[model samples]
Target: MEKYLPYAVLFLRIALALTILAFVADKMGYLTQAGTAPILWGDWDIYTKQLQAILPFIPGNISEKLAIVATLLEIILALMLLFGVKVRWAAIGTGIYALLVAIVAGYGVGINAILHYSLLVISAASFLLACCPIYKFTLHGIKKRSTYHPY
Candidate 1:
């Protein structure tokens, strides 16, 4: 059981990576389902409407910019996790980002979605995996032993 722990962590890392990527794809329109326009609106376009609906104090353009930046951050974080470049920090950032989204948008949705989307949980999972990276199948793992000597 102890020996397979790395594999388990790797599996969790990959799962979180894929999960984040799926959301990115949805935002990028590679996986938008029909009739979701009423709810999801499919992409960064939802940023304006959602921000306005939840926090009307923010300007429309600022909300749009936030959406774009958030999307980019998600993309970067996903890539880092997928490639195992900086899994720990990426996971932490992912968690923080997801928590913000959960706080702002999670409230407006149904209990099921709030739970299902589970960004906050995703955040925790990613961060946990970061603490014990397998690195057996990752590019970063191959280059050299990670020098992440946290103080």
Candidate 2:
């Protein structure tokens, strides 16, 4: 188990990053018309609508703006994790973001939707990554240890 810790962290990192990117893609319309998917919003319009539905207290204008902000944050977080930049901090941020998402989304969609979307799992994985002491396969590690000369 100890020997596999790094691998597990690596797996979580990639999974979280890709999952975030997928949602971002869906919001951007890339995954529009995805076939019978469990939890995709399809495009910005649908995403905004879903956000409004989830938090009906918020005005529609504010909800649309919130959706945009959320998408931007997801993109930044995903890129940071994918590139291994500030991994631990990013993981913490990811954990917090995912947790908030779970709580808010769960409020509207219920336990089943939260479980189906794996938001809690994503949060847990991110927190696990933050607790890990070392990451052996980051871009920084590759750059520092590489013997290749570009000169």
Candidate 3:
């Protein structure tokens, strides 16, 4: 179990990054998969509509802009994690982003089977990942061992 830990952590990191990317893509109007089914919403609509639909507390005028900001933040954290620059801190940021997402998702959609649980669980998992100190490809490790000052 210990030997495979790095691989497992890497997979989780990739999964979270991909998840963030997909959300960002949907918002950017690139990955449209709405299909012909009227039940499904359009990819372009995900940016503003989903937020409005999920979180009524947010004002309609600023929802889209706030979403864009959130998306960019998520992308930054994801990239940091993917590049192994600062896994621990990036993971914490990711977790915070996920919580923000979950706050909207959970309350907007209500506590349902997959919808609410998925967001909450992913946010929680990110927090858990942050607690782990076994980052394989990260600058955090090097920083820990360095006793030299670059000033």
Q: By TM-score, highest first, what's the ranking?
A: 2, 1, 3
Q: After superposition, how far is residue 14 of candidate 3 from its true place, in Å?
A: 1.2
> Highest lDDT, which number?
2
Expressed as tens digits, the lDDT of each residue in 8-119 for candidate 1 is: 7678778888888888777666676534743344655554576567766778878788777877888899888788777777878888787777776666654565576787
Model 1 off-target regions past 4 Å?
34-39, 107-112, 145-151
In order of appearance, the predictions have TM-scores of 0.81, 0.87, 0.75
Tens digits of per-residue lDDT, candidate 2, 37-94, equal: 6547766777788899999999998988888888899999999889887788889999
Candidates' C-alpha lDDT: 0.71, 0.83, 0.69
Residue 25 displacement in candidate 1 (angstroms): 1.3
Name the TM-score of candidate 3. Answer: 0.75
Q: Rank the candidates by lDDT, best first.
A: 2, 1, 3
lDDT of 3 by residue, 77-114 (tens): 88887777667778888888778766755566765723
